[model samples]
Target: MKEKIIIIGAGVSGLVAAINLEKAGFNSVILDQSDRVGGRVKTDYREGYQFDHGFQVLLTQYPAAKKYLNYNLLDLVEFDPGSCIFYHQKKYYIGDPSRKLSLLFPTLLAKIGNVADKLKILKLSKALKKKSFDDIFLAPETTTLVYLKEKGFSDEVIKKFFKPFFTGIFLESELTTSSRKFEFVYKMFAEGSAAIPKKGIQAIPNQLAAQLKNTELEFNTSVEHIKANELVLTNGKTLAFDYCIIAAEAWPIIANLKNQESAWKSVENLYFKVKEKVIKKPLIGLIADEAALVNNIHYQPIKKSDNYLLSVSVIKQHNLSKDELINRVEEDLAIYCDIKVDSFVKYFKIKKALPVMHTVNYMMPPSETQLKDRIFLAGDQLSNGSLNAAMLNGESAARAVIAKIKNGFINVN
Candidate 1:
């Protein structure tokens, strides 16, 4: 008989785990507390607009994503290669001239950084391109801020460009995330486009979930406690399993698990419907002001519709009320776009947007994935905070389980 595996959390990790297990001739059951899939990567449609749970983009070059996902089916809409930096009461356009030749003159003239700084960007990209994924993550670790300074990036560029840009990505104002993560993300951006599915970000997970033929997904089913070879549900029911995988954030469920990081980064995304396009191009806008409450903005045009959907992200949580926050965001948008924005639609304050990891790895070893005799753990927290990491760890855990089953190391009862 095939081993009865129970995987917790129907997020990308859990879904991928089940997919891989099924390929290896073992079927698994997935349990999730939420009503749907895509734990943090969900999307909501409101009044003819699609708003992702948070401002998110899928880097098309993610190795694991490329391996598993069918991008053509996603109907992705790509963002322009660079950013429109709002600095000192002016908008400066900067882009990778290598990718788009038209951006060459604009990037050179943009005052966000010096000519040498721009050249250094190309050099950095070239250097990172030669470094393999293993090399990037295994290199000595340090804060991204320190790494940039060591690379001789000027303060002007770091402040007006890298700081605001990566702050939005990392969800941390300070560039204190590991340099390894920065390199990995930078490599991804340099290699491919940052895009979202025409439907929404949730489509990525929906695609993965749809591929499961043998796995059973049980939603709104919470696992209250994980025990030895069994699970206790919140409704006072228990079920036995030959193997269990904690594909969710393990720190919360497994009490004895060590080295699990629970600290999470937060972000607030405020959406608005505008009559005119706030940004002509599909490029991310960064607020370079040190004290600006609005960290970044993107205006996504709704297909076959007259109105455009504007998404403004604030990396920090403030004491301001919803009205106050909206007012401040409107003020910022007015200055950035030179047009008034008052059509406030919704605000998404996500407290656990991304896991905070000081140290990161490309993948975890099989031996490390096994928490106990018959239990395992998998998530982005096990490696780095990215969709790529989540999928990588999930497959890693699934392979570990497959190896054990093939070796007959663990008895199936």
Candidate 2:
């Protein structure tokens, strides 16, 4: 008989881990607290419109994703190569000239940065491209702001472009995220196209879950406590397994283990269905004016309907009712675009959207995936907070478990 393994949380990491373990001939059962599969990456539909829980995009060049997912199956919708910055009552375009030649003149004349600052971006890109994936993170680390300053990026570019663009990505306004993550993300954007699955971002997780032939997924089941190889669920059930993997976010892992504290950032997304497309092309509109509540607006088109989808990433969490927040978002968005945001609105907030990695944490060796020989941890928190990182860590944890059991260190009944 194959060894029994219990995987907690049906998020991307957990689903990927189960798929990998089952491929290795292990009996894996996945348990999740929610009915849905994707944790932070999810989508909801209402009255012929779809809204993703958060503003998310897949980098087509993610190494792990490219290896695991069948790109042709996803049927992705690609976003334009660059972004349109709406600042001070004008539109500025900054993008790769090789991808879109039409934006060449605007990109050159845009006031976001000086000619020298624009040249620095090329230098930085070339420098990062020369470093291997492993070496990028291992290089000297500091705050992203500091690193940009050291690279001689003008304050004009950092404020008008980098701050708005990266804050939306990192969900933090100060650019205090580790420079390592910044470098990696920049390289990804430079090399690949940003896209969304035709259905939604949740489709990525759904694809992984479908590969679990030997794994049983138990939904709406919460694990009350984990004691060694024993798991007690909230519904007065206990199961014995040879190994357990806590493949969840930092908050849930901390809740179960009852220790360890890490700083996290929160983000709020306001979803709306506008009557028509706000921008002519499918692109991201960034708010260069830092004081606004909306960080960036994503223009998503809908098929078989004239209405289009537009979601604004709120700059910070607000303490207001649904109606009140919507009103505030409208006021801010009007200043950026010339369109009316319609009624069908939904508010989504994630308290721990992304883990904030400091300079010290970036330099330290990653926490061990194996804990106490029986339990293992896997998630983006253990690695960088990206879908690729999460899936990579999940696969790593499974490989470690396989190695341990094969070495006769873990006994299976």
Residue 25 of model 2 has an lDDT of 83
Residue-level lDDT of model 1, residues 35-79, one tens digit each, is 998888999876668889889999999999998899999999999
Colliding pairs, model 2: none
Name the 10 consecutive residues with the lowest summed lDDT in model 2: 359-368
Task: For each candidate in turn, give its C-alpha RMSD to the true structure in angstroms.
Answer: 2.4, 2.9
In model 2, state the lDDT of residue 173: 86
Which residue pairs in candidate 1 collide? none
Give lDDT tens digits, candidate 2, residues 1-413: 47888888888888878877877788788899999898778988777766788888899988878977887898898988788898876878887776788777878899989999977876777777677777877778888999899988999999999999999888988898888899989888878888899888888898888777878889999988777678888898999988888887544443455666777888888887788765677788998886677789987666436667788888565687878878888888888666587764688887778877664222112236777667887777786778888887778777777767777453321
Clashes of each: 0, 0
lDDT measured at residue 227 in model 2 versus the true structure, 0 to 100: 71
Model 1 TM-score? 0.96
